[model samples]
Target: MKLVRKTIFWLHLGIGLLAGVLVLMMSVTGVLMAFERQIVEKADGFHITATGNPLGPEAHLDGLRTAKQPPSSLGFERDATRPVVYQFGKEKAVFSDPYTGKSLGNGNTAVRGFFKFILSWHRWLGREGASQATGKAIIGIGNLMFLFLLVTGVFLWFPKRWTRSGVKAITLLQKRLKGRARDWNWHNVFGFWAAIPLLVIVISGTVISQPWATTLVFHLAGETPPVQGERKKPAPFTLPESLAGLDAAFATVKSSNPDWQSIQLQLPFAKTATFIVADSHRGRPDLRRTITVDLATSGIVKSEGFDDLGPGRQTRTWIRWLHTGEAGGLPGQTIAGLAATASAVLVWTGFALSFRRFFKKRRAAA
Candidate 1:
């Protein structure tokens, strides 16, 4: 039993040494992005010139005629004070006055850009293009290693006898300790408290990162995963020259969900039909619905609420919310953010302890 425990400790130490930097980077970035949408909205300054009965998508599309790529989505919140958002290809977007079609430009483009930049590093290791695949692979390994560290750290931190002194060291943090002892205590304390949420964040992330993990999630839930690219996509919808169809379609969808906080029309650059997602709260799966509208008929083609999802897809959707801690609202985000912060501390202290032991061994030999 002693030998097994010793082996687990060495494995944990070695993996930490190998992947500590990656974990540290992810942890720090995660904390930074915990309140991203709210920060961006605050930065946007909530400019409202006028609202209610705003112009249609075609007018916005015409306004953006010079854009290199057509926007994929556009929408307004129920709040007249908020600017309309036009999401272009990839990370590009423009916020504009809903009443005048005037460009708001996100109030602070730099702040928006900053979060976009951080998000790139957090998800893709700051790698782009074909190299993003390589970065993701490396990040996946780091995630696995980080997850293992949390598990093993627990075993090593558990006091064999559960004495009062052991409980004090593990639970009650000491501020005066120095050197390796201090680092050891910090690492254990942070790791112990942060384990469950870190596990949640990491495991949800792993399911997101790996296709097999995604499939396994479905399998574990006793459902077969949907085949990729198997569903036949509807033919693209061409917009009418009048563009009146779009306004009518949006109105038809809006009339049904009068209390929607925001309703975003997703074009997907399709020819005749588009999807509008109406939600009372951002990231709240329960309060959301997707409506497919036909541009030609100005009719609802289909509507799907959260309850309409299959068990497999529903669980999959929640994975994203859980990973971001939006599932439990603000309190969940607080816990997840704090856990990520602690994870950062754990990595730093673990590395410090490892290096102290390494140098101490070399000095003794000399």
Candidate 2:
């Protein structure tokens, strides 16, 4: 048992030292992202109250055009407790309101700004070339290292356990210890408690960051590349056939899903394209609603219930939802926020421990 602890101890210490900066970067950035909604609200002068009624995407676009500034692209998005917001580029274009048009005043986050800075530092170290790639690879590799840290931390915590006394010892914070043991104990206790959620966070995070890993996930979940369109310079807006008579399509979908909080209309970008509408109530996965209308006939071409998503698409949705804690509604989002906050604490403690050890070694050598 001592032999196992000694070997795993060195392994954990070494990797923790190697990946410390990356973990700290990720943790600090994650903490910032946790309060993203709040930051946006404060920075942009946006109100997050319920709209009670939202206009169709086309209507909103027309409204923007009336204002003499149509967005290059319009997106409908949700943040914690807010109705779907119309976004143009990086900020909220407007909240969903019935009568008057009011801009949300650019919903940028102070927290997110700091978060982005940390993320850049973490991902690129603000450098270039193969060095940038090295940063990403190191982060990816650090995720794996974290998993090891969690496991070994658990074993070390339970040197010969399965008792109330041992468990209590694990739970207690060791603030008084002065050297390697202090770092070792802190790593063991916090790492054990934080194992499951941090693992989920990191794994889901890695899947998002690594494109090839994401593609592999798609392949595993049975997703093939969607059929591609031949390259063609598309015509300027010619009263899109698909959207020409969306009144009936909108009525049909609304009639079917009366509980929807908001329905977003996505106009087709080019010839042979299809217009799309997706609805959700509180952004629940099960409530995912979509319909595609054929441009030629102005008839519904395809519709998808949330259940209809293939495993690959489902996997994609799950990872995104999981990361943001949108999978579980308000509860999930709250949990994710808490996790991010806790991760920041973990990073701080981890850094203190590692640095303390480094100083001790220096002192001993001197």
lDDT of 2: 0.60
C-alpha lDDT of all candidate models, in order? 0.82, 0.60
TM-score of each model, paired residue for residue: 0.89, 0.74
Clashes of each: 6, 0
List the candidate 2 regions with Cα displacement exceeding 4 Å. 47-58, 64-86, 89-97, 102-105, 108-135, 174-186, 219-244, 269-283, 294-299, 354-366
Tens digits of per-residue lDDT, candidate 2, 249-303, equal 5555556665655555543344223323345533366666666654446566677
Number of the predicted model whose lDDT against the real structure is largest: 1
List ranges where model 1 is wrong by over 4 Å: 51-53, 56-69, 229-239, 268-273, 294-299, 364-366
| Residues 49-122 of candidate 1: C-alpha lDDT, one tens digit per residue | 66457776767767866665556678778877877788764567778877888887646889988988888898
Residue-pair clash count for candidate 2? 0
